[model samples]
Target chain A: MTTQPNLAMRNWNQRVGRTALYLVLILACVAYLVPLVVMVMTSLKTAGEVQPGTIFMWPENPSFDAWIKAWSQACIGLDCRGIRVGFWNSVMIWVPSLILSILAGAILGFALSRWQTRHAGLILGLVLFGAFIPLQVVIYPLIKMAANLGLYNSFAGIVVVHIIFGLPVLTLIFSNFYVGIPVELINAARVDGAGFFRIFFGILLPMSRNILIVALVLQGTGIWNDYIVGVSFGTPDIYPMTVKLQTLVGSQFGEKEYNVNMAATLLTSLPPLLLYLVSGRYFVRGITSGAVKG
Target chain B: MATIEIRNLTKQFGAVQVLKGIDLAIDDRDFTVLLGPSGCGKSTLLNIIAGLEHQTAGQIMVDGTDISPLPPDKRRLAMVFQSYALYPTMTVRKNIDFGLRVAGLPRAEIKERVRVTAELLQITDLLDRTPARLSGGQRQRVAIGRALARRASVYLFDEPLSNLDAKLRNDMRIEIRQLHEDLGATAVYVTHDQVEAMTLATRIALMNAGRIEQYAEPQDIYDRPETLFAASFIGSPKMNLIPGTIRLADGVPVFDTGSDRISLAHYPFRLAPEDGMPATLGVRPEDVAPDAQGIVARHRLNEPHGADTLAWFTYGETNLSARLEPVAARALGAQATLGFNLHKLSLFDPKTERRL
Candidate 1:
């Protein structure tokens, strides 16, 4: 109307507001993506570019050298290998541990929910509380005991350790999920003459679709990411990814090679991360469904 | 299809005694209903008979075998829960036959039994459906079908119709009654709804705070309630009680219901206890009539429930009600009186509220 705060002032104010909003959004996006972007770029870069703090910049010449090296060989105190040396060993320990822990946790959960015996709350509370305990605190005693039994540093030893450590949280999650179910379901099963194990296999197990998926995702992730337990208890024959990754990106005395480290890290986390991304929607739905049931 | 005897059964959870010494014998085809309010321990008794719950002390003889030591599977009884407890993961067909297969029945017989039960319940279409996809009414039918498929000797229903909507509940109630008639299997049902108990039960065992108040035919329980709890609980809108003294008027016993008195022409039983001392006289609202000769009460509020009219009135401090015709209750907010037949009057000892 009148002067309208003059052309230059109005234009400058509009420009500033729009610029600030966009700057914020850009910062947010960069803040989140920087680590992942750096990881990918570092994986492609040579050793010299990584330590110079030019991580935000792109690799001068992108190469598959780090990928091949991480998969085949990169020295770690005479081993001269990357993630490959222990990748299969990690697999050997994880596959069985994940399977057995879920089985035990699921069974325990079913029993706690369906069968109403005395001390149900107490048992449930103990299992839930056990999940919060720091696993590192219990590692030494477990390792000593494992050695005492002459089962130390073996694949079976590590698998069993993973199972024992994994059971508490897995069982807690499963038990809480199962308790949301209607007692009427179990009662109907019982009235149909289905006993303890029968009801679990026939009724409870089948309905536990989403919870089982979530349990798989959770236990799979925990077992895959396990480090201290695997390193301390597992033998040289079965050192999983966590320990192997640490050695892959070892000391800073020599020019560090983050290229191979990034590749190794991404490789190790890929399986469980992919597992979660695929089933993340189901996981959310499972928890929300249980919340509304009660 | 066998008579069951529950003798001197008692159950205690830790230090708290739930069911104190209960004894009853049910016939081979009796539709026995354990009717009571919540926390009355009726469900506990049913579970005990089904062998799902063990008695702290006593014997349960099912078909003349002591089944106290036996588990629920071995006892051969079926139960229907309130929530219908349908297996959501399995199809209805699998849910019904899950038990039979576990019992090691032949596949051929299982199929035959499933067909027969589905036809009987008219649930042939629901066989392929899982419980999650089922509506409330459908889930209920599937639950009944589950027990029906078993061909178990005894059936226990713990408020099975409680989860259904009102209209559907009535329909299911009638269907369950008809099914019971057709099968004539020995059954024990537990429910808080006295209407369900009255309509479905051949004999109602009225429980009050873990004790059986009375056990008799529905008609007998209604017409002549043994205790105050049964009389108050077994009917809709409940009966009204007026504190009045009994006196020998006109050479016969008569009850003075505060404002007015009723003279018994000739009641089958004594009008009052041998020494009742005229404590409290109970009269059902339906029986209390709006007439000049009846007890007078100022009309306070009128609630017209279509077929019947419920009028709340007052005589001094005591507010009373009479269920009458709509036209009769049209003269609202006026001093009204109602006549009560002394022959229909129920006398209860003021202290214990037990009918005399």
Candidate 2:
């Protein structure tokens, strides 16, 4: 009889705690959504309606004129063309950079994990050290090196820069993942007449679905959103979407067109947003298995 | 099938010597088990034989040819790992045919091998499924099938059934023994489980502290362990080692535990017994029984295992156990007399801890 009342009291307390938890979660969701909502509303509104008092208000005259303007007619420095040029360049740059970096990282990670040789630890430590150093610290030297190699202000320059920066983290993640796999598996493969590349492609690569997705998402978003590397290494013609967006927002003349700026900003952010939405589940799984395992 | 020889195999890991000067000659078509507890370097010795691990100093000879310099694959050996080590991404069919394909065998030959292997393991229906989809026993069968499919010169098993439940381990143990006989292949198996070692090994190399303690047939090892380590390590209930001394009562030598005197006339000692020499009396639980002419013991505990009762008793300050029938166990009251079968007991020199 005493336990019954105690159980009831515990149930009531649990209910109160659950309600408070949901309340806090809902508030956080609203706080996160408010900026995106405001951007959407401002992008839809005309120049006259976009003011401080009208920030929370819906667009009374909603249209795609700002989107079309941002996509085509917005001026980015000397080029009066839209961000589409940067969009295509970003796509071309991202595809090759992501592929090359992930491939190099996976091979290096597999080799380090399976085969122990002299300086393996030192090499891993150096690569991880590369990941920790601020990018600004090495950007100047890389720019000079790119110039010396005739890659400066070229299409390949930005791609190569992204790959170099992407490798350290990508290699670390991949190596950690591969290290978690049982040594017996590698030994078994070796006994089965599989050499280095054969075991990697046939055995290890096929099993790297989740970790590959994680690497893709990481390097994809990284390369796509990159601004400083693109501006530093790439010419105006081959500038990425993020750099082009910055040019459009900053180069606006006379009265600012907030709608077009907001539209371009949202457009610039869409690919990574879509990537997260698509691979978010796998990304969580990969991080837990690879990074958090230690 | 061919004979394999390991001569002066030694492995050093940093400061610790894992395998210190190991030598063994395995016969053709023999199931040789490297049996020991963990850290005994049985697995390392197996790896050295397979060429997976490079020995610090050794030569592995198969059919009198030194294969020590060859890599694992070129050594013509197949290994079934404890974890199964099945490629999780590949189907069972691909997993079995992996080696043959790597060897550049004809398409038809690879297919035939896969079919034969899958059929042998009774996993033909599971050929299309990946290892992730298979149960543990099925995976183990596939691992065995992969090794069997290769038809290599030597087969190695590294505690393959230690991952399974007790019932499944027994079933797999029988299957492995059957397969060895069926194929007549030269095999080396490593396991810490004494039951697996005893049941599967045609010739058992019992190891301790990086050295082989005893190498003989399973029954011989059990009946006549050369060292106290072998005697205690092999039995489940554990051989009881009673500290005693050898003294001459009249002319015949007798082992005198502090409280009880046991005759050593029937003991097959390698050395002549000396008076007042320190010794250990090794007695297995099953060899002890209730007898009127035995030493008096105070019954301490009774463990009624279904097959037999293991009644634990205290003789003076030493604990002794007797494996008896349940009825005989119940008849053992607070105080009972216990006798050890004379012929079955082992007499170890206390100083050397070896059979005397």
Candidate 3:
């Protein structure tokens, strides 16, 4: 008889505890989502409806005029075209940089982990340490070096900068990922008459799909959204979307168009958002598998 | 098929010497097992022969040609790893054809070879499936099939069945032996299991601490172990070793155990026994049986093992085990008299640990 009452009380307590946990989780999620909700709502509202109190409310008469204006007609200084002007430029800078950087990183990581030289440990340590150093600290010297090579404020200059900054993290991801692969597999390939490149491309590279997606998400977002590197190194004609977006929104003397600005902000973040949505599962698995093993 | 000759092979990993001047000659079409406990450099020796690892100082001759300068692929050898090491991303068919494809064989030849190899391994239905979808035994067959497709002169197995369950291991062992007989390929297999070594090898090179303790046929190694380690390592439940001294009583050799003296008059010694020399006597458990005219010992424990029961008894300070029929062991009470089979007894020098 006592056991029956005790079991009922225990069940009640568990239900209350679970409900409280769910309530707190919901509150946290709503708190984090508030700003994003406000941004989208403001972007959809007309200019007159975009006042302080109406920031979080759904627009009564929503229009995509701001999205269109932001894409092609909003003015930033003398240029009235908008964020669309630098979209192709951002793609050009990001795609080549992403490919070259990932390739270089994978090769470096493979060599460091598998065909280790005497200095591999020291070099890996140095690379990992370099990941912590602020990119701002190296920017000035990089500018001088870029100018000496006659690539300052040019497309090549920005691509090279992205690769350089991206190398440390990319190499760390790939090296840790490759370390989990058995050494016998590599030996088996060698006995199968595979040379270094053949084994790497045929055997290792195929198995690295998950980690590669993780790297692409990281490097793609970082390089795509990069503003400082673009501003410091890109010329006016080759301004990346981020630099162009900054100039579009950073007006000094005109009445601010918050709707247009919010629209542009969402547009610039769309690529990374779509990437995460597409490859989110692989991203989580990759990080845990590579990082947890090490 | 090729005869492998390893002359004075030595390997050192920095401060630790892994292979200490190992010299072994494997005959053509032989199933040679490198048998040892872990860290005995058996795998390292196999890797050196396959050219996957470089020996510190050695000359490896395959069919009278020194293959020291060649790489693993050039050595014409294929190996099955302990882990199976199948490519997880590849289908079984692709895994089998990878070596030949990389060697740039014609497409039809590669296909025919893979088909025949898969059929040989009885894995034709599994060729389209990835390794992750296969069972452990099937994965091992695919790994072996990959090696078979290579058609190398020598096949190396690095404890390929260590990961399987007991029943699967037994089935695979018989299959591997049958395959060896059918192909007549020279194979070097490494394993720590004494049963695997005994069942699979035409010759067994028993290694200890980077040295070959004994190298001979499996039965020869079992019957005439040259050292104490060999005798102890080869048998299950282990050979019972009794430490004592050889003393001359009436000009006849006698093993004096301080508490009991056993006559060694009929025992054959590798060398003539000296009086008052410390020696260890070794005898298999099955050789000891119940007899009225034998030494008396107190029965401590009895372990029933289906076909036979192991009876433990104390003789002096050492507890000795004997294999007996279950009924015979069960009939015994707190005490039992055990007799040693003199013809099968082994005597070892205590100092050198060699058979005397």
Q: Would you give me the overall lDDT of model 2?
A: 0.90
List the candidate 2 regions with Cα displacement exceeding 4 Å: A1-35, A45-61, A252-257, B240-277, B283-345
Position B5, candidate 2: lDDT? 90
| Best-matching candidate per TM-score | 3
TM-score of 2: 0.88
**Candidate 1, which segments miss by more than 4 Å at Cα?**
A1-29, A45-61, A75-82, A125-133, A251-258, A287-294, B11-17, B51-56, B249-251, B257-261, B270-276, B290-339
Q: What is the DockQ of each candidate?
A: 0.55, 0.64, 0.59
What TM-score does candidate 3 reach?
0.90
Question: Can you write out model 2's per-residue Cα lDDT over B287-350, one digit (the tens) per residue?
Answer: 9999988789999989999989999998877888899999999888899988889999888876
The order by descending TM-score is 3, 2, 1
Among these predictions, the greatest DockQ belongs to: 2
lDDT of 1: 0.82
Model 3, residue pairs in steric clash: none
Residue A149's C-alpha lDDT in candidate 2?
98
Per-residue lDDT tens digits of candidate 1, residues A176-287? 7888887766766676677888877777787787888878888888888888888898755578877888766764556667787788888888889898899999888877
Please state the Cα-based DockQ of model 1 relative to the true two-chain complex.
Answer: 0.55
Q: Where is model 2 chain B poorest over a 10-residue stretch in terms of lDDT?
A: B264-273
Q: Which candidate model has the greater TM-score, 2 or 3?
A: 3
Model 1 Cα lDDT, one tens digit per residue, B1-356: 88889898889999888998898899999999999999999999988887677899999988898988877777778888887877777898987887788788999999999999999888899899888888999888988888888888898898999988999999999999999999989999999998999999999999988788999999888877777787788877777767777666656666766666666445454434342266566677787777667677788888899998988877666667788889888865577767776667677777787877
